[model samples]
Target: MYRSHTCGELRISHIGNTVTLAGWVQTVRKFGSITFVDLRDRYGITQLLFGEELNKQLDENPLGREFVVQATGKVNERSSKNANIPTGDIELLVESFSILNKSAVPPFTIQDDTDGGDDLRMKYRFLDLRRNAVKKNLELRYAVNRSARNYLHENNFMDIETPFLIKSTPEGARDFVVPSRMNPGQFYALPQSPQTFKQLLMVSGYDRYYQIVKCFRDEDLRADRQPEFTQIDCEMCFVEQEDILNMFEGLIKRIFKDVKGIDYTEAVERMTWEEAMWQYGNDKPDIRFGMKLCNLKFPAHTFPAKESLSSLIAGDFAVFNDAETVIAIAVPGCAEYTRKQTDELTEWVKRPQIGMKGLVFIKCNADGTYKSSVDKFYSEEKLKAIADAAGAKAGDLVLILAGTEERTRKATSELRLEMGKRLGLRKADEFKLLWVLDFPLFEFALEDQDGGGAGRWVARHHPFTSPKPAHIETMINNSPKVADLDKYLEHPYAGIKANAYDMVLNGNEIGGGSIRIFQRELQEKMFAALGMDAEEQQHKFGFLLGAFEYGAPPHGGIAFGFDRLCSILGGSESIRDFIAFPKNNSGRDVMLDAPSEIAEKQFDELSIKLNLK
Candidate 1:
């Protein structure tokens, strides 16, 4: 055997016990006659001392860093214990040793604080994984996985395997296609989620199903995103939205208790999608702090007897008054912003695709006076009214954005986050719970190949979503005139509401799922509403629709982002830290060099051609 006990198993009680241990050499310190070697493995590390006789052997056959070895030694109480490590209280007195394997000099030092850049570490990932910090991350990942499995098993959830090679559906993100060798010219796309299979499992009488599986998506990558990722996916039969939410909420609490020993027993807050966007400017709002945007309308004293909104709208500032919608925010205790700071805020809105023209600011002085870009356009009375409208107290600064209504609202929201960062209000560890409800059923993003120009309409969320029963009549009968630019008006399918819920944490959407349309007719109607032809529906979700015919139970479930959960738990900004082998920003596997040209023979067998652009 390579070892009798793990490196972590030895303690003071194991003194005088003859032990056989095996691990890679962590460090070697030689003191002429006596030599000390730190033997390390996944479990832990142990210090091994070689006496003078063995030291002479070591001179000829010297050990190097990361060299694998096996040793038989007598455990003894350490003469000088290290308080930092668990196995520090004991040491091994080596009697004999053998080199199991030798390692080439690693490109980078295998230290916790190794001086290696991201690209270098990724290229030599094997060596990088040997670092204590990297090993600890992997260990934490295992602990999380084990904890989730245990929780699911205890809750009577069955672990069912789903096919990785599955049919592709053209709905959301692009797919990673795999060419079929036997069936030439045909392809199989990877499972985005086990979405349809889990639903089918419900129909096949599996009351509960869960899989900690890999999901693929071909989309733009971010620090927290990857081309391939893992999820704690699950589905439950005969359950409502409340049932799924309560059950998964418990799962999260259990993970916290088991993994980090933190108890999140309190009920998580909920917010509608509409409210979340209106108040925080994003679907996944970071509720950790408050710098909420407040609406203020009307210009100054000389205009009308209306309340003044000089901070946002002014006679001279045509940007705000000219726009149909203008939004503003108040930043507390930052009334003394310098010209450089204000210029920076203006430049921020000019980033490509964000599409905001500029920003307006009003700094309310301590003595109730205000300094603003639109100050000349309004009197003192007008300034006070505008300040009051914005809920801006003395010593507070009010910021404003103006453009097209949608763009202005979006810009105002971005400004809140930016100012939050500058004010140190967006704390990661401090979680703020909220429930955003009451979302619109449909959103138009041009027609899906039906080609109706601005008159086209589609589901805001998805066609499977159930419309609010009260608004059903309005949605079905009314084809009212709606603006093309601001497409928030009533349409043929505007009243639907998916039985969906998203759990957001620390400004990141960690989980989202919806109660599916179980009825075949309803499903078909949904497809028809989305402009899918009968043939298209049959080709895409025909199997799913057929499964519903076999007495399928009403089911719903949510998938938790295992990586994002761990990232939040570990207090890291990027989820890649939790993922063992994550790809870089460009979706390239630095270690493996994937997405490369396949061998010509292999491509020919699959009847594939690489039309590289």
Candidate 2:
């Protein structure tokens, strides 16, 4: 019962109304004996005036920053109004007040524009939460949750609770294990996602299910990734891929409308995985710009004349001749690039991760002149012909990368980003959504393949995905061929498309899911194709297999990265800004200093050994 009305709820209409309000001291302005203290709370701020009458009390008990106080005052209109704040036109004429709580001096300023670094802010997160920017972010996160929940509830989806400490099965990421003290030497893993449980819910005849749940992944972190994150997980039974897609699309549209007030009327564009890779050199392509890499050495097309080759491809450029794939990128209107600029581009490709041997360039000059790194190899006619083939006009530059397939693709992606920066194409506010579908059913990891990939076909998506109808016969036909040493599994796994789809937003994969195989025989086939023997399958996923036996419905769903989605909606690149308490790059909770070792007694009870290297 600190106050009747909130600081933000007062306005000119409440003038002459006696009220009591309490908040932390934001700022204090003094001119001679008259004093004004800005009292702040989560709602807003109000200026409290202490006249000569209360001057002795105010002077004796000085008001410092962040001191929580209770003040009973009469609300009055301000003589000089502030146009900036909502309560600008009003001030409180204090009748009486008392200090409730005092705070020690904070480590950093609690203003919206405080010049505090990430580490400092994270360490003093309690103080940081008082900043207006952080407050707004937290409020926006709440709004997102509300909008999502409202939408789901209105659409007949239940907000179900899933267990966190569940049995561990390997997904793509590493599990965070929790030791069970009650059961010695046994452990329970924090769920990466409620994948199995949600599927079980579908078997229990819950047609639509959703959860705003925490998921854990003990993996290396990136700018967009965290060790622990939240997902707006959802699943629906007896629905096709189209139904799931449309439902989620509606949810996204509703969120945008409710939170951002922007109408995304256009239907989300769809592109096959092959098309995305071929056109943008990435499955999650940023479609805002178009400097698409064109394959120059495609065997389908006839070789261009020597005039085209003379630029770089013409003569004895052994790199291009020896390359399995030759790729080129067009830089619009950069034909007059200096030697230093050209060298910078060359150095960019030679980064350790990209691993390109070198970058070759053909600068198409005005007046029909040309300059190139490989000018020695190509004659003028060949250079012009090559420029023509690249569709490079005068004042354009064509960069070519020639190397092994892997190196060339990586280099091409990096080069695209560079050109994107130059062209001012990667705008943060502008969003481009694309659906990338038709991913391969299996991938050949070299180490896993060394084990003869026996029974072990790695999921290109996941083992739950249903193979495309056209590839079912092919998969069955080749299943046993690999078992026989005399024969080979000649059926290309790359061509086998899974019933999978990924939603990409501005080059980040926002969400992905696939139509799951419901039939037990199909599930067994999928496991066997991944090289899982009957015993191994039963041991790892015996519960799921048993659940399928009790009349499971065909189900599929997608989980949106709620943090990342909110970050994008809040106009920030990093998800850390949207999350309330985020960990550092190395996954340390700076505030709590988590992951500290426990006492020996606790470890003994759990039967865990701490073997520090």
Candidate 3:
């Protein structure tokens, strides 16, 4: 046998026991007559001692870093134990050794704090994985996966495989297509998520089905996103929104306990989509801190019930009065901020990402005084009123942003998160879970249709999502057309809400799902609302619509972003590190050098030609 024990297996209890160990050389040190080497494997590292005689052998063989070696030795207690490692208490006193293989010097040091850039590390990812830091992330990822599977299996959810090569129905994001060689001219698109098949499984009488599946989307990449990613996809039959919520909440909590040892005893909080947007300016708000947005002035459509503060800023302040929205948040203990600090904040919002023209501020002084940038537009009393409306206390600074409704709200959200970061409020160790419900069933899609004549309605989630029970009639009866662009808010479809919910954790959307339309008529209507004609719907989703005609049950399910969830649990901001062989930000596999061109003969056999633009 190459080895009797792993590098990590020996301990003080095994002292004086002769054992064979095999691993890669991690570090080598010489102490005059004696030599020490650290042997590493996937399990752990163990120290090995080379006596004067064996030291001569090591010198002749000349062991280097990452050299694969096998050694037979007696386990002995270490003179200076390394408390940090599991195998610290004991080490191997080598009697004989063999160089199993030699290795070239790696491009980067195989250490946790390696001196390598991202591209360099990615190119040498195999060497990078040898680092303890990266190994721990993968280990944690596996633990989470195992925990989720165990929980789901206990809940009677069957693991079923789904097809990767399926029809291309371009709905939400672009699909990555694979050209078919067998059926020459046609192509197969990868499954974005197994949305249709899982529902079909429910219709086929499988009460509970789950899959730790790979999903693909041809979209822009971000820190949390990849062209191909995994999901903890699940579907259940005869379930309402409440049942799915409870079931998945249990799944997440069980994962927390098994992986992080966090009990998470507190009940997850819930808020309506409107409430989340109104209070925090974001659907996925970080509830660990409390800097809720205050709507000073906003459009009627945004917060239909709340009164606007037009009267308070109804002076020569054109920036506030003319803007479609004005919003603010109170930054505690920043009332004495210098002009330079405030200027820096102003520039922060003015960036193209935030897309705001300028920022306004109101300082609520400790001595019952008020100061503001718009002092010429309002008096001390009006400034105090504005600060009071924003929930600013004494010795607090109120920061405000005003512009178009969408831009202003988004900018305010980014600003709030930035301030939260600056104040050290968004802690990685602290996790807060929330559910944002009652999203709009349809979002105005002026940019989606050709010619941009008048915006057509598009499904906020998907065409399969059922509308809220009360709004079902409104959705069915009203034509999803806007006669006037200015009065689109008056359309009945604008008021309809979906039976959907998104689970947000620490300002990131981890999972979302909605009760599906079981009836063929409602499904067809949903397709029609999304601007799909009868023929187009028949071409794209005929299989699903046909299945619905038989005996589709009331099914609802959610898919957790498996990578994002794992990263969050591992206290990491990027999912790439948690993923093995992940593509870079440009969706290029640096190690494999994938997404490359095919041979001309292969392309011709597939009846394809590349037309580079």
User: Best-fitting candidate, measured by lDDT?
Assistant: 3
Cα lDDT for residue 609, candidate 1: 81
Worst 10 residues of 1 by lDDT: 298-307
Give each prediction's root-mean-square deviation over alpha carbons. Answer: 4.1, 3.6, 1.5
How many backbone clashes are present in model 3? 0
Candidate 1 ranges with C-alpha deviation above 4 Å: 297-312, 336-356, 433-435, 447-455, 459-463, 468-488
Per-residue CA lDDT of candidate 1, range 1-613, in tens? Answer: 9999998789889999999999999899999899999999888899999999999999999999999999998999988999888999999999999999999877888888898988999878878888888787777788889999999999999999999999987546788999999999999999888888888999999999999999999999998888999999989988887898888878877877888887776778888876676567778888887777665653221112444444434566566668755667889999988999889878888887567877778888998788887777777677666667777899998887766656666777878888888898976666544444446666665445324244455655445555554654554565434555444433444444556788877787878777777888767766766667799899999998898899989888888898888887777878787777789898888899977877899988998887879
* TM-scores for candidates 1 onward, in order: 0.89, 0.92, 0.97
Which residue window of length 10 is worst by lDDT in model 2? Answer: 299-308
lDDT of each: 0.79, 0.83, 0.91
Candidate with more favorable, higher lDDT: 1 or 3: 3
Candidate 1: count of backbone clashes, pairs at least 3 residues apart or interchain: 13
